[model samples]
Target: MDHPLLLAFGLLLVVEGLFPLLAPQAWKDTFSRLIGLRDGQLRTIGLIGVALGVALLVSFS
Candidate 1:
């Protein structure tokens, strides 16, 4: 596709689906644990993930 954002989102979907598709039970367990985490803890995790993604993109580019 000509749109880089669209392609990136599509790839993201594929990667995100892999865990659930390959090991549904494990995914369910992990999700259950995630649900128990506090909002602050989840926000921290999300921030770290975003930071890592940005770092990777910066390094590659």
Candidate 2:
């Protein structure tokens, strides 16, 4: 509760766990498709996630 970085990482783990816990097959299928994506496509998706996270941090914090 006192450490923001630790709390954020913990929350991330919870969020990351949801898909597999809720639908393991779907999660596996999604990753299989993601594995087939080009490197640029994966980079773009990662960039989008980073951008969204930064935007949310700026807006909320």
Candidate 3:
């Protein structure tokens, strides 16, 4: 169980890290646009995604 969690984390890190190296300018532009998003809006969107993910996981488990 722990091994799978660690593997997931490692995969996330690798994908996230590679994006910047592979597309630095695109990442910068995208992040700048993301930063323009209002805090409340971002939080709401994030919460919705988290909630959906949790529901799916719970149902699957």
1 versus 3: better TM-score goes to: 1
lDDT of candidate 3 at residue 12, scale 0 to 100:
72
lDDT of 2 by residue, 1-61 (tens): 8999999999999999999999999999999999999999999999999999999999999
In terms of lDDT, the best-performing candidate is: 2
Against the hidden true structure, what lDDT does model 1 obtain? 0.97
RMSD of each: 1.0, 0.6, 2.5
TM-score of each predicted structure versus truth:
0.89, 0.96, 0.68
lDDT of model 1 at residue 50?
Answer: 100
Candidate 1, 1-61: lDDT as tens digits = 8998899899999999999999999999999999999999999999999999999889987
* Clash pairs, model 2 backbone: none
lDDT of 2: 0.98
Displacement of residue 15 (Cα, Å) in model 3 is 1.5
lDDT of each: 0.97, 0.98, 0.89
TM-score of decoy 1: 0.89
Clashes of each: 0, 0, 0
Candidate 1 clashes between residue pairs 3 or more apart in a chain or in different chains: none
Residues 1-61 of candidate 3 have per-residue lDDT tens digits of: 6697798789879988998999999999989998999999899989998999789768987
